[model samples]
Target: MLSNTTPSGRDVLLPMFFIGLMFFILGFVTWLNGSLIPFLKIVCELSNFQALWVAFAFYIAYTVMALPSAAILARTGYKRGMTIALGVMAMGALLFIPAARTGLYPIFLIALFTLASGMTLMQTAINPYIVCIGPRESAALRISIMGLFNKGAGIVVPLVFTALILSGMEHVSEASLGALDAAAREAMRNDLSQRLVFPYAVMAGALLLFMGLIHVSSLREPVLDAADAPADAAPRQGLLQHPQLVLGAITLFGYVGVEVIAGDTIALYGHQLGVAHYGVLTSYTMGFMVLGYALGVLLIPRWLSQRAALAWSAGSGLLFALGVALGSSGESTWSQALLGWAGVPAVPDTVLCLALLGLSNALVWPAVWPLALEGLGKHTAAGSALLIMAISGGALLPMLYGHLADVSGPQRAYWVLLPWYALILFYALAGSRLRRWSVA
Candidate 1:
């Protein structure tokens, strides 16, 4: 709902570049939870159900705070909204210091929630801001470039955590886990907690500094003349009427669920499957994500349409899930290299499955957004906020995944994606056809 006061210019790329950098940071910070879930679960001695609250607290903030974010944008406009969001994010990062010091699981979840609330606001401002900065036809490519930065951070943050947390110590056996004498365990816990102190402190300082930089930057506001506004102002209509848009939202929701499941769950899932070190899969999965985005940046609109891209992506997901599940259940060499290890391969095969999942995920998000908001002019921002609310799937679906992991084990829990993927495939093939229904 934020409006800009300045004219669009030829050099929009620089500002978009900086914006992409901030998004990269956001993605880095956001996806690090994938690593933290398993790490903190071990350090905090959590049950599968309890540990997954890491995602629940973080992503549910979007459902809670997105409307408020829309309200803030309407008031402060985009530039000031971003500044406020960065400042709040800095405060959230600082909370991690104390949360780490206490080694209390709930406090860490609270800190993550606080942090995610800030991201919710930032995402609300950022995604549309990127779109309005350029021509709509090329939006996916630009967003894909920005996504490269985002998923690129997802690759890096886990590597950093691995070096700092996992690799630095000896691999603790399940037999020895949570069995330390009280004083030793407490000391180990405190030491482990303090590791977060410096990283988060540095992040807080960076966010504050970024806030100042954005305040001083030469970013231009979008110049929307009256001619560009929506053609219609009808107040109440069914989203079902806008089937493509509805389908787009559904696609986005399902895409986020599977992507989070693939990324965040990989570490825990790997551990359960007897992969001794799961940190390595974090970077590998994100590498596939980056590759997918890079491919999208190249192929979309030029060689392929967004709808076509989404369909292929969904199909890849279905195939990859089937390969992983079937391979795990059977004992073929392909299954060993692709799903498990030894003569059976664990890390490599699981990584391959996750990587393939990432590839399938790459196009769904970038393509879905623009297609969803295609014709809704004034309602565009509201519709965007609604889709942003749907990102709450990042929170809820993962909990369901964690519960499934708890009940039937990680590999079996992957059955969760079947329904999610089916919905998306339906949207891509049929839901996009709803554009014919809109008369306005």
Candidate 2:
């Protein structure tokens, strides 16, 4: 039984490298929104509520384009679909060149939506590919490692955005803007927006280069065979009978909502507290997320079951959410408790708690995918798209949090995260196990 369930070690070697590369660049692009939330708030002169539409525009594309992406994948196959997706992303990157020059918020949004559309397609293709490529027992670990590539954005994205864009600004603070008269403010906004041009130009070039590399590369589509199919469901029927898929989508909806709130909002949270260099604060969250994924990589299946890992993640999320809402607003003593010796900037206890949400969020995605997609068989592609559509949680939830922040204060807005984590916890303990709406 052990021999039958485990795959040869060499089978996963090739797919892992290329897919890991894809996930890394994908993460590099996605987490830039964290830095961008604050950066764009400055450049576009947006209110906190209005500024979070950056996240709304980027993530909503996943919901909006996911089904179409699946259809394209069916016709074009995964390899061609990935290449096409990258090319679309390249075009989206180029759009930033003009949006930045004009200093228009709407154009930046269009650029984000376009970029996310490509990612929607890429995500629809890659997620199931990764899951099916390895032994079922170790799928979470494989996906966890893939997650490290994505979460790596925590470290790399901020430095790139801050050094490239923020470096051009003489002073980047609300207090400095308050001192400016109308004309200077407009001039300053235009100057700050234009600095985005070079970085986006470089991103477009890198995207196109990767597109070509994928077009010529050796990444083969993984074959999904009888051995990989789950016994629980018929392959060709509609997914209505699969409560796991439905509940899984709901789980992801809340999970992505909390995840985005944690990753994207930290910089803005720091900005509200008037922390120096608040734009880099998202990296702290990403750093913790990377740590969580590292643990997932090591302990999953071998030392931890997927269910146990997810249960721990959801519970910690609740604790961290509490910390964010009610923790001290004072100095930096506890910051050392997390990873202080590494030179992560000291933040208020409340904000550090928010960053620690990354640790809580890290395993939810890795654990949820396999549980949801198990036994999906021919519906795997469709199941993947449904899960991808769940990404809209990031799109809608943050806008509501932003509105709440506008009405209440930023710290008060964190109360919104509590219920979502609770819902995710429910899924971990019991929701993922239900097969039918009616009790047996």
Candidate 3:
């Protein structure tokens, strides 16, 4: 049941506004990795495998800090936890100054870890709060609405990074670096790395301001009671006994992995395919995500339930993943047909298929959260933490893709996403419904 004190209709607007802002913050910081990957590859003189540790260090923090976030939210409440998270994130943003000054890859990874730790806190607090606030049936719908705010920022973060950092900077490939002497290469790297100092400074200040704003806001802590519990709720021995939530976490693991690949690696692959505007490639994926969220907002619960939407998303992911793995590397009619007349440059068929994964992935996170926690009752907090921890998929899978790219090539590396989508397709079809580990 929905909490009595939680807002409804117009009353819901204020709380949603604050949560939506946090989601925007999440998207902005997270999606920047796509641009940063190619940029840092230049600055740090790293291989594809080494560069993807950018994602690894960032997302691994969720697994490390999610349970701690639950404990902190238990005491400080959601509003205070979010405030603390922003302050922590601001500190991490300020850390970028030194990282830029020295141009040390390890320091940059440390900064990213700090930022993700804070983001983990924010996500742990907000996801359950959003789910438990409204009618249970519409929880997926509510999350999809939040997805608009989250992915809406994804659509712009890379473009902003490009305009601020990549523009006017001399582009260098690992291939081109061989021509430059050591001193000259070091000088160029220092100059390129220094560009980050100003933007991260600005980001730190914004995070501090947002922290203060959240501290002063009137957001309510979510009140989860027995009303939210399902009748078949199991004993609290361990959350592992619950199959729906566990399977959902696994589903998220795969979902976020492929989703990260789609959103973050498109630029690298585009650059490899000789696309000129590769830096802004993440925007294509995010744009498709925004469109998918809009469709979810309109159609969910009204015309389609969350489970059905997940099925469709998974199927689309399978088709698109195959396209990415096997489709033409040459420029295709897809981008021209879809975005050409809009004055947008056309990308290769393979890159377009990779971008389409964002559409297939848009709804999985929102739909999985509600379905996973459905019967948890008193254990919902722990369940949410577990789901949040599963974001390590984003860390691990991309590293795998990067390694595969190095050994074989970036194009064939997309084959890694096939099994991931297949796992999610399994969950949407059958796994989300299981209560115990049995065949029931």
Candidate 4:
């Protein structure tokens, strides 16, 4: 049985490499929203709520486009859909050039929507591809490898944006702006805004170039089929009956919601604690998450099973969130140590909480997929799209948290993540079971 169950390791590597490249782009774009939030607020003069629409615009694209992407994949196959996603990302990046020139936040959001819509296409295509590329026992391991590229990008995105934006902001302090005449201030804003031009232009060029590479690449196009057709058939029909898929969608929804909240809200949390330079809080939070991802690369399927890793992570996240809530309530020293150690320049405690949240978040996506897609052969593509659509939780939940923050304060609003982590814990337990409802 062991001999018969061996993985086709070599056959899966090259395709996985290209798939990992797409995941890298996903992480880079998603995590860069951290920088975009503050950058847009300064450049476009947006309120906190308005700036957060950066996340809303980008993640909501998944909800709007997932079904459409699935349809395209159903018709066109994975390789072509990936190529189209790349092309669309290029278009989205190009829109930034003009939006930057005019200092128009709404146009920037439109550009984000285009970019996210493209990612919606890419995610819808690639997730199932990762699962299908290997034996069931090692599917999570392969996806974890895919995630190393994804999280590796997360690690770098903020540093890149910091190099781009922080230095520019140094030129526009209160004193500098105060000294400038009205016209000069306007000129300064325009000049600072234009800094976005070159970065986005380069991103557009890379995206377009990747599109060409994908167009000519030899990646296989996996397709959805009836469950009984072949051992490797994509489960098209029994998907409706699959308990794991249903529960996994809920799990993904909760994971993205909390993950977004942890990363996106921490900067504001730092500000509430009277921490200056809250602008960079998001980057530090990603560092925490990347640390966890690094561990995932080293340990998954070696010293840890994905389910075991997820359960442990989720439990730790719940504990960390509790610590954050307590620290925010006036226990500043503990919170300071938590946040500061992660290199966040603000109230160190808040940064620490956010970083610890990253450890909890680490195994979520990689763990959730294999459990969800365990037996989904023909239905893997559609099921994965449903799971992708659930990512709209990131778009909607943060907006809800924003409203709560406005009314209650950023720290108080963290109460929401308690239940979010609870749901994640549920999935790690019985929710991951493949046939929770079946008579079999």
The root-mean-square deviation over C-alpha atoms between each candidate and the true structure, in angstroms, is 3.8, 2.8, 2.3, 3.8
Candidate 2: C-alpha lDDT: 0.86
Task: State every prediction's TM-score relative to the real structure.
Answer: 0.90, 0.95, 0.96, 0.88
Predicted candidate 2 versus true structure: per-residue lDDT over 380-436, tens digit per residue: 678888899999999999999999999998989999999988888888898888777
Over all chains combined, what TM-score does candidate 3 have?
A: 0.96
Better of 2 and 3 by TM-score: 3
Model 1, position 435: C-alpha lDDT score: 74
Q: Rank the candidates by TM-score, best first.
A: 3, 2, 1, 4
Q: What's the lDDT of the predicted structure labeled candidate 4?
A: 0.77
Worst 10 residues of 1 by lDDT: 225-234
Q: Which predicted model would earn the best TM-score? A: 3
Would you list the C-alpha lDDT of every candidate in the order shown? 0.77, 0.86, 0.89, 0.77
| Candidate closest to the true structure, highest lDDT | 3
Candidate 4 lDDT by residue in tens digits, 22-95: 99998888888876776676666655677789889999999999878988876677789899999999999999
RMSD of 1: 3.8
